[model samples]
Target chain A: MSPVPVLPAIPGPPLAVNLRSAQLVYGGLTLFDGLDLDLTGGCFTCLLGSSGIGKSSLLRLLAGLTAIGVSGDLRGDDGLPLTGRVAWMAQQDLLLPWLNVLDNVTLGSRLRGERPDRPRALNLLARVGLADAALARPDTLSGGMRQRAALARTLMEDRPVVLMDEPFSGLDALTRLRLQALAAELLIGRTVLLVTHDPLEALRLGGHILVMSGRPAIVQTLPDLPGAPPRDPGDPAVQAAYRAILRLLEVVT
Target chain B: MSAIRRGLATLAGVLLTWQMIIVIGELPPYILPNPWAVAASLGRNAGSLLSHASVTTLEILTGMVLGTMLGSGTALALGYSRRARRWLLPMLIASQAIPVFAIAPLLVLWLGYGMASKIAMTLLIIYFPVTANFYDGLRHVPPGWLDLARVMLPESRRWAVLRHIALPAALPALASGLRIAAAVAPIGAVLGEWVGSSAGLGYLMLHANSRMQVDLMFAALVTLATLAVGLYFAVDAALKRLLPWHPANPETTETG
Candidate 1:
């Protein structure tokens, strides 16, 4: 358990995201229409919604992982296109089974035909408690371990903005709590937008909690809670915010 | 160990049954040679048989390599381009509808009666299976993986996505195609030799049968079977080694 090294901040100021009049339709079904969202830079924003409420779809739109013909007006705070500046983590780990953990973490660099920074990747893996599993294949890992590896890979990208879609939804309670804390520590000062249905998760990790609901999905920001993320999940203030989020979800759905 | 034992036991049982049929039917040596006679013939004509066997093996190997390369190349092209899928896929499928043996004579006419004609025939036999299986594999990459690729890699790096992600993911499927191609590779070479060839096991079989050398013909048949089975196992072993990430079936562990 060596002390974690300080990660250099991503170059340039974090870029805020703004979506205006964005619409997504599939097979004549409107998933969202004229959706507007303002995500402040360097803030951990968690989106809460019920199943099939277009939470993942909105994240995909922000990450630019949407299918062809998806209509949208998405821009950064600098009024420039937001492509190539995002690191996305999906619900599934999506680690290449053919690659070992070390190679998988360095995938971004390898894909760009640049030499993978192996020491940096190994350091990140150590922070995620996967330093010894660097040579192991993804198929050999358990669900929580795989997600941790995915987190290490995501952090290796060093992108200013990170979009995560229910990254910890499948983990057990204890593992989820531990990973949430690790993610918060590693992703500090980066613009992170995490989509999850867990109200408590939003309270524990998000600085700004937004609930997405309705047929044509819209965003409603939850009341800002006291203290930074990795806050006490059992704290009275955090529990109150959790109840408020559950109630808001109840009314919206 | 059990699988090999079982296979050997089955072969012995079949041989016993064949000998029984010969005994019960009271067939003469000229009409149907017994297993003993075939074995004796194999030993007696080992020299000539070995030469012809080597020629057939060369034809099958050459054709297998060429066919796999062409088939997988075509599959990659079809997988990458919608226009190629629309225009060439149908034609590729239609070509398979025509029996490869039916084109043997034409191949011999064009490529001549040497190893070229036999190799061409084997390649034709192999091309369809390799193309169809590899293309299916390439097309059916897990959607989650593709979505990850879309988010991580920019549009300018599409080639990288295909190379690093799609290609490696599709290898197991390609390996399967290669295995099938190897199994059938002998069929094309033998058929081509039958259509028109001065040498090869198929030609030797025809020549021996014409001269009423039934034992020699039986020996040639045995050699061809051994060659086909041997080639199939070689390819399968190579594929297993190449795809270490592909989990081997737990229920059927390899003892050897």
Candidate 2:
């Protein structure tokens, strides 16, 4: 028999998520009602808010882990569920205590009943500089190392859209900066949406900042961020952009 | 100053008091044999008793293995499928309320005066805690972690998730169950032997007690206590080795 023809792998459709007339209610109060968000493909958007402005809730909606089921009133455009298209990294780096760094990094794929790919998992671990700690359990790792492992795991799903809810909030300044650079390098062209309280972090990584305030969010999209992200904040254009976002958030001294 | 030194001192004092009691009481030898008498009896009967003890140990080992396999398999079944959890979980709880003491005689009647009866008795007693502990571990994984699995992993990495996440998360609880089961397994075997068996440590104790061999009875009782402690330590050591990341390991205390 002749050699069988090998088919090229199918490419995923571009990420285009829309939240149309979405209403969220907790207890007697309404968090956001009639909220509409239109996100095009390959844009890094940050949702900036105060402590209780539902930034994490929005991320939960995208990830589909929230109490509200997908059958509820909220609908995502492009005929795909919000969760199916997006991968979310929560605030806490919830690595399993028993698994080492490499195993934890590959957990997402493993848990969803996928075949084990050790080399790819190792490569991702190496990317996060956790290749050396691959055999060490999560409890043996430092806080920063755990978070990096979580990041590598998040990247392993190969989802088109990535949603992160305050993934770097608890880290020290120096470590946070280093991770910011790592995230920028990792999330080059993926459709990224993140929730963060830190204006500096948002400005550093996000190409577009969406301020979520009031009952529903009133999004302000800012394009043309200078010198790209992972750039130093001391740059003049970056400083200007920071000031502009700070003014938009209305952080009065 | 040290806790171990204090503990040793306490134990020596207790032994001295026991010796004083034996000297003062002038008790009948058959009723209250002295520690020295019991020791002599143990030395004299060591060969026969050790063989009987070995039989009981084998029964405990067989029961422990079978019971753990059943318990873990049930826990895994209940964990992955909700329908099984709804039915089997309640049935497991109900089984615990029916005392093993009540069922040991029945097991002996059915399986005859043999190792099978002793193993069944141990399995009945040890199965509950293992299943409950492991099931709790499997079901109660953190929501954030499951989300991490869904988002980060592909179709292939799911089994690794169960091993790395489900197994470890449940381990502390499972260790607690196994420790309880280990002690109970020997007791269960002895109870079964007491009901029907002609050999084993339980039978030896019963025979010695009926014949007014007080020293021999004390020897058997001491052997049982030693067996329990040895089994406990063995299980503890195995758990520590299996899970080096577990908080029990002193070498990995830095993270905790």
Candidate 3:
């Protein structure tokens, strides 16, 4: 008998979102066809690809925001819907400019019929080092602060799975690194699917990176990072993985 | 260079032209009353004019409130429900097409010379714009915001979502509706009274015109004009007070 491959013990509930022969076509252009994925729980998987290679669409499919093709088949474990239970943060901050920081973070609670827990929201903000800016409105906040507030809001939903679509792509390097660390720390026990074009970001943050190609995506599962996350992206191992992802993206484009 | 200075300069020019015309022409006293003659008429009829003006003011005030409430209430109800929109929107548009002047006498016939006819006329005239504006505002909420609401919250809690997100977003349109209604409200009252009533600025003008008291007719016309301007400014002020972020709000935008 063959021995099973040993994996690290993951703390959260097991998640196995699998897609089989999933095809997406819009207006004669094929975004994806027969794409398949088996997302195992408790690992940060980054889907790396060039711009407009259906990376965002892939995340949307997993998040169940898009409909699966009628002729194609897609399935997930437990039949649990991701909407409201899986927090999806889009590329834009999407904060209500009229609402202050605390209100914005607690917005999920307001949406889900829960009384806004200001203290908990405040704590989350403080964890992100934004406690002092709680009362300020989103328009008054800087770009970095607004993104942090958006991240805090994404956490407020308390979802087990988080799908982030380039949440820190537009930020300056220092702010991006700071937020990347915060995300890694907060997402320790959760299942995270991050989509990014930057190979370095994928290497620094992802436990396992999936490189996708073609109109119909085919996944090339890359090696896992040896150590804990929030890794120094400049490390040799991380650089090697980054180069591999760059090659994958290059080939796909 | 400045808008206020330009406005003042224009006002000064108009007044000078008016005064010159009065001085140069040997015009009939009844045709175009001079500014001084009108002022003298106002002073002479101050006591009686004040009493009549009060009655007209009451009608204007009552009609304006009733019209605004009815218009806004219907707008909100129709806006919040698809059924209301499907049925009521077309009806509202058709109602606007039915001329208020054509209906004023009929309203007087039904409601008589009482304040009811005047308010009914005002409500009918001011309703279309307010309802249309409000419905469009509520309908035009950004798609992204709606997706955020559905993704972040439960279905049962959508009321709070609508209240917090949709209401404020719809406010600018509502303000615009209110401004138009304010301008239209007084005209409705005047038209209602013009058809059948013995009171209000409309009736006073009718009485003066019949008596060949052209100066007095001009005075009532002036009073009506002032009421319309005053009501419009009052709405503008209220809008600024409630929504300081509105683009037309002079204080906030100017200071920053």
Candidate 4:
């Protein structure tokens, strides 16, 4: 196939999320109760916590995903349900093994019984630095490349709200940094909730950093971000914020 | 050794061993004819044997096609509905309890001594494995993929989950069932022939045995084995081609 021009960048209109009085009670444990959270429209929110905390549950609650035991009044500021408007990305790429990269990226269209827009898919692949590998299978790609294809798939959805659960946590340090930068750049002007263990990643890419802590987890800090994401890690302010948040999430004795 | 050479050597050794056993035992022709006697019988009765071989081949191939279609259909039906699984599964297992060999005469009696009886036997023999394997595949689809399908796909096109995800995921398992079917399919057809038939290699073998034409009977048995082996490899090759994208890729021979 001939090279198709890249798809024009049209950012989705951002939707502000208000999850109010959220409570979750599982078997014998209460993860969180009477907690309020807000995802400011068109801003990146990074959620950092220890493993087994309610970070993922919170993200799932926002996504309206299956079997989330959380009870909350989750609504967009514009008075619309958040379910249909959300796109989800996960730690695993979740690309079907049988499909080539391009087809996987355009899967939403195929699943919806619409003819996939090939040019748009190709353009997204180009943006992800996988234009040449559009016809390549998922198993053939490296971990970073597979995740990039997934990022392209998420971008194709063009939903105003994107909920991601530790989407870059599995990558090597360098690859994770690169993907984090790439995600922040591509996800401009949308509501993005990212659950991650990396405080440095949160410092660099999060427009608003949130730290969830305690048994009945609560959002501790919605730290005031100095500027929009793709933040410079070399800055002293970022380094200082990283040190503080890193202490909260990890036990680095 | 390479695959072809290895296969050839195995064939030669088997024939050599058979000749050795006969020579050592000095058995009568009626007990076990020498390989040369069988070869001579094959050549002399080539035309009649060819007709009978062709009939048996037809029965095997026709049975395979119908069996595969019906087997896969049953598998789909079982996978498609919980109610079908609840009812059909036990009935299928109970059917297996009735030894197929014991029922061969009744099957011939009911369907008559024709191709219909033979085909039904083949279909019955293959149905369970196909349904069980394919249903297992469908049931064991990764929960993550279905979750994605639920989110990405619209609610109205729910069947698309089975089509795009579950069906493709289940193919390798289905292929396995088909392989077993192909290997065992000849037994059903031949069994039907042995019970009661006017044609096919089984009938010819029974006739030759009754007439004390031991060499002709041996020749017909050899022809049946060759047919079965050929059918197996053909199905194996086709199935391998059919599942290029499968996780195992079905091409592990070159690793050595």
DockQ for each numbered candidate: 0.73, 0.43, 0.42, 0.58
Most TM-score-accurate candidate: 1
- Evaluate all candidate structures by whole-model CA lDDT and list the values in order: 0.90, 0.78, 0.77, 0.85
Instruction: Please write out the lDDT profile of model 3 over residues A1-253, one tens digit for every residue.
Output: 4332222234358565666776777667777777777666656778888887777777777665644442344454767555555778877888886678899898877766678888778777877778789998787778898999999888877777778999999899999999899888887766788998888788888888888776666778998888888899879898777767767767533
Instruction: Estimate, for each residue in A160-225, the C-alpha lDDT of model 1 and write its tens digit.
Output: 899999999999999999999999999988989999988889999999989987787788998898
lDDT of 2 at A43: 68
Candidate 2, number of clashes: 13
Model 1 shows how many backbone clashes?
0
The count of backbone overlaps in candidate 3 is 1
Q: Tell me how far candidate 4 lies from the true structure as C-alpha RMSD in angstroms.
A: 2.7
Q: List candidate 3 segments past 4 Å from native.
A: A1-16, A19-21, A66-79, A170-174, A251-253, B1-10, B23-26, B46-69, B72-80, B154-158, B245-256
How accurately is candidate 4 docked according to DockQ?
Answer: 0.58
Clashing pairs in 4: none
lDDT of 1 by residue, B117-225 (tens): 9999999999999999999999899988877777677666778988889999999999989989998889999999999999999999999999999999999999999
Writing each residue's lDDT as its tens digit, candidate 4 over B53-96 gives 88888887787788778778777888887898898888878777
Worst 10 residues of 1 chain B by lDDT: B149-158
Per-residue lDDT tens digits of candidate 2, residues A189-214? 77788889988888788877777776
Would you give me the overall lDDT of model 4?
Answer: 0.85
Which of the numbered candidates is closest to the native, going by highest DockQ? 1
| CAPRI verdict (incorrect, acceptable, medium, high) for model 3 | acceptable
Ranking by TM-score: 1, 4, 2, 3
Greater-DockQ candidate between 3 and 4:
4
lDDT of 2 by residue, B1-256 (tens): 6767887997789778877887789777887787789889999999878988998998999999999999988998888878998989889988999999998889999999989999998888899988988888788877766666554543335566676566767777788789889978897899999999988999999999999998999898888888888898899889878877766656754322
